[model samples]
Target: MIVHLIDGTYEIFRQYYAPRPGHLDGDGREIGATRGVVQSVFTMLQDGATHLGVATDHVIESFRNNLWPTYKSSAGMDPLLLGQFGWLEDALRALGVAVWPMVDVEADDGLASAAAVAAADPRVEQVVICTPDKDLGQCVGGKVVQLDRRQDKLIDVDGVIEKFGVPAGSIPDWLALVGDTADGFPGLPGFGAKTAATLLARYGHLEDIPADAADWDVTVRGAAKLAATLVAQRENADLFKVIATVRTDAEVGTVDDWHWSGPTAAFPAWCERFGWPRLAQDAAALAAARS
Candidate 1:
């Protein structure tokens, strides 16, 4: 069995910006993103993904905000995008899809936790983390790979090495050094992508990097300034390391909660509510075929 964990926040964002049009129910309600998720998951299941779980931010504020005041906040996000979170969760559940509504933890944390637990189960052949977020790369193990559903690409341990130029184990350390704008953190001032990759490739971690730029050999420009900045912000670096690391210990109730048993008997009702005659037909057909 291959466990598929999804990042619901990222999906909502993607659907919001996608070329798709807004969806209206028979009652003239908006559920476009919810409808998009349904379409995406159907494609995943039809494309050979078996066991699946989708994690969404029940609330955007998490423990990371306590660590850094400047961390990404859901505050000021577009209202339309924010409005879809609940509708999406409800729609997913109404369709019998497994949903993790994250609160103090996060969507990524749920994916990490599920991946860790599922990977440990000997019956499971592999665990697939489905998201393009770089933070989740830290959880990639030999049996676990990251699959970008949008791009139709699968990245293994070697792909992590190829793109990040560092092993999966060192991704958090590399991210801490390079910082991530998407996560709302600034990395060291002088460090660029190449320089960080080169040093991390050699040293494997931030602490292992030499204190003296004079001893460097990777030939990154302004190595002295980079070295000084790292040394000066050592505490900040460690904090960033903690922030960059995804917690694989979220208290998800159980894997049975995530089994992909297909859509519910209410599929037709849900489709009628959403005004998706085509999806209603597809669900009925898929359910009947499975039966």
Candidate 2:
């Protein structure tokens, strides 16, 4: 069996910027992103998806914010888009998709957790992490791939190596050195793409790197400054690693618990609230088919 793990936060962002207008359900509840999310999930289900799970950031402020003051916070986000987070999770559950709404942990962490759990199961043949987030790359292992549902891109372990120029294990260190804008932390100055990879490939981690540029063995541009910056901001590199590493300890439930069983009676109420008549019928049909 294949497990398809989706990044619900990314989906919300995608639907918010879509050209389509807002959708109003029977009770006049506005559901723009929620409708888009249901459509995307349905499209995937039509494309032979069996075991599917979606992870959403129930609260945007995760543990990463505590580590770095400049890390991503929802304070600047649009209220309309932020309001849809909960509705999206409810809509997915109504459509029979397993939903993981993370509070302290973010959606990426939940996807990483799901990938780890699925990869360990012998019954799960492939675990498709359905997001383009770079952090999820660390969870890509044998038979586990990252799927960007928007672009229909499937990223495997080789794809991780090809994209980052390092193995999956080195992604955290690479991200630490390179920095991530989405997470809101700027990597060390002069530590661009090539320099970080060569150093990480040589030393395995930032901690093992030589403190002085003169002690370096590998050749790269601006080596002296990059090495100097790394030593000067060793504390920042360690902090970035802490932010980059996705936690797998989230309560995503087991594979059997995540098995799709369609929706219960609450599904129709959700559709009615959102004024999505067609969705109610389609969801009911899918639920009956699975039963």
RMSD per prediction, one decimal?
1.8, 1.7
Instruction: Report, for every candidate in turn, its global Cα lDDT versus the true structure.
Output: 0.83, 0.85
Span of ten consecutive residues with least summed lDDT in model 2: 271-280
Give model 2 RMSD, 1 decimal: 1.7
Instruction: Look at candidate 2 and give me any clashing residue pairs.
Output: 25-274, 25-275, 26-275
| Model 1: colliding residue pairs | none
Looking at candidate 2, what is the lDDT of residue 23? Answer: 77
lDDT (10s digit) by residue, model 2, range 1-291: 998888999988998898979876665656778888878887777666778899999999998899999999899898888988989988888777899999999999898888889989999999988889889898887878888766878888888878887788888999999999988998888788788888887887888889887888989888878877887888999989989999999988888877776666677777666666677787667767866
TM accuracy, model 2: 0.94
| Residue range 1-291, candidate 1, lDDT tens digits | 778888889998898889868887777777787778877877777776667888999899899999988888898998878988998887777666788899998899998988888887787898898898888888887689998988988889888888898999899888888899988888777777788899999988898899999887778888889999999999998899999988888876566677666677666676776677678677556656765
